[model samples]
Every structure is written in C-alpha cells, then in structure tokens.
Target: MTPTAAPVLIVEDDRNVLDITSFVLESAGYPVLTAMNAEEALLVLAGHPEVGLILTDVNMPGQMDGIDLVRRLRESGNPVRCVVVSGDALHAADRLGDLAPFLAKPYDRRSLLGAVQAALVA
Candidate 1:
C-alpha cells in the first residue's frame, strides 16, 4: 500500500498547544507531523517531503527560532510555506518579515484554520 502524505508540520515547544493544533488539523483531514523544536522539525521535514506547510511558534527551545528555521529553509530553496504563531504580536511581523504570515497567540479556531488555509494556497 502507498504511504499517506503529510501536508503540514507543526513545530511548537508547548505540549498542550502542539497536541491541540495537531488535533485540529487532523480533525480537518490534513495529515500533520509535530516537532518540539526546530532541530526536530528539520528531521521531520527531511522525512516528509510531502509537507508543504509549516505552523510554528516563534519562541522555541532550540538554538534556531521559528523565524530562523523558516529563513534557513527558504535560503536552502525549500518552498514549504510557514505561518508563525507567537504571543509577541506587536513585532512578530517585523521580526518574521517576508518569511511567512504571523498569527498572534490565543488565536481562535477560525483564525488558525484560516491562516493555515491561506498559507497553503499562497
């Protein structure tokens, strides 16, 4: 049998947030991979070429933050779209500038899903 494709990868250090995001995406019928940090996220990305979208938290435990991770990927010619979720709404756009869209923390289900949909279709 052919393996299922994973279209989205969620990188968040917070366990609860990760679980909730994964559940939400799964409920929407999108296959997802979860990673606690950028390092692990790279591994998941390497393993899942089908992943076309990345939902990540700006503040993470790894040396490379979410923005940096996305920057690296873009620099390396990886076309996977990224959406950054963070509590720091005031400057997330400035910090993440041109890398991807920024969704402030405490986002509602509609906002979250909407951002994902927009990024995917962008």
Candidate 2:
C-alpha cells in the first residue's frame, strides 16, 4: 500500500499521550492504531500489515523499548517507516542515528503531524 494511504501505529506508554496523539492524527483524517509498549506494537503490526508508519516513544514499560523495537523490525527486514519521540532528544538521536526521525516530547499538534507526514513520505 502507499504510505499515505496506510495506517500509522502509535506506540506510547502514557495513556494521555497515546490518546492525544491518536486524537490529533485521527482528527486530521489519518488512520491510526495504538499500543502501549513495544511488544504490543509488534503484535499490532503483525496483525495490521497495512500500517506504514510507526510513531513510538523512546521510553516505555516493556522488555524492549522503542529503539529495540525499531532495531528488531529493521533486522527482520520490515520496511515500515518510524518516527520516534523522546524527552531526551540528544540521547535518542545518538542512539537512533539515521534509523528514524526523532520528535521531542510535548510536541504541538502541527509538529507531530508534520513529522508523521515527513516519515510517511520518506
């Protein structure tokens, strides 16, 4: 499927953040799916092959955080694009390198949507 037409999976541990992000994307007319952690995100991806983008938080309560999740997907040859969000931008950028785009925590709706759109097209 074309990335623009596919769903965006948001993986975040915070309920408030997840809900708000989902709401923002959905309100803007993008299809969205959500998971609270990397494991759940993996499961959701397995079931939803149409998910073209993943917007995941770097820190989460699970065996694997967003970085590991992205790494695993890469190792397995999953081509789904990713946009990672974290409060610690420098640390996350150092760890992520060119793996995915990074968005800082407490982002405004426009920034969040812009990052997602950029990733989708990338």
Candidate 3:
C-alpha cells in the first residue's frame, strides 16, 4: 500500500479561514494541520517535519509574524514550502520575494489550491 501524503499546515488567526482552508485542501486529498498563530505553527512544524507545505496568514497576533516565520524557516533550510496569505497586499507581497510564494486574502479557491501546489514544489 502507498503511504499517505504529508499534511499541509494551515496557520490563520481566523477560525473560519482555518476551517475552510483545511476543508478545501483535505477535500483535495491532502491531510491537514491547523494552527492559529506563528508560535503554535512552529510547534506543529517541530513535531511534523514531514509537512509538505505551510499556508500562513501574515498578520497573526504575537512576536513571530508570518514573514518572520517564512524567513526563519527558509534560513534554517527546511524543505517545507510556504505561502503567505494576507489582506495587506502590497506590504505582504513585498516581503514574500525571497521567502516564498504568496496569496492575497479573498482569493479564489482555485488560486489558493494552485498556490499550495506551487509552494509544495518550491
């Protein structure tokens, strides 16, 4: 039998967004891990190094914002792909350049899934 695919981590402060993201990705055949903040996300990542992708919202409440998380993870040379989602379009877009791919809030489900696929490839 084939092993299951790696889980996709969804880190968004909004419960609804998290739920919907998890639902969408899981429905598309990927397992899901959900966290509300960057710190919790880091904890999840520490335990699940096999996670294939991280979908995070930039304006999370706490010390480590999404951009910081992306930078840190990339610096550590982890293979986990990242996609930063935020309402601060320009600001977040600027920060994602070297860190990872990104998607804006209110994005279409197709776009979200597309980003997930691409980030996983990154």
Query: What is each predicted model's overall lDDT from 0 to 1?
Result: 0.87, 0.92, 0.86
TM-score per candidate: 0.92, 0.96, 0.92
Q: Total backbone clashes of model 1? A: 0
RMSD of 1: 3.3
Error of 3 at 15 (Å): 0.4
Residue-level lDDT for 117 in candidate 1: 85
Model 1: per-residue lDDT, tens digit, 57-111?
A: 9889969999989999999999888999999887777888877899999888789
In angstroms, give how far residue 99 of model 3 lies from its true place: 1.3
lDDT (0-100) at residue 89 of candidate 2?
90
Candidates' RMSD to native: 3.3, 2.0, 2.4
Q: How many Å off is the CA of 78 in candidate 1?
A: 0.4
Candidate 1, residue 69: CA error in Å?
Answer: 0.5
Off by over 4 Å in 3: 1-4
lDDT of 3 by residue, 33-121 (tens): 98889999999999999888889999999999998988888788887888899989899998778678779898877998888887766
Number of the top candidate by lDDT? 2
Candidate 1, residue 18: Cα displacement in angstroms equals 0.5
Per-residue alpha-carbon lDDT of candidate 2 for residues 38-77, written as tens digits (9 for 90 to 100): 9999999999999989999999997999999999999999
Global Cα lDDT for candidate 2: 0.92
Q: Which candidate leads in TM-score? A: 2
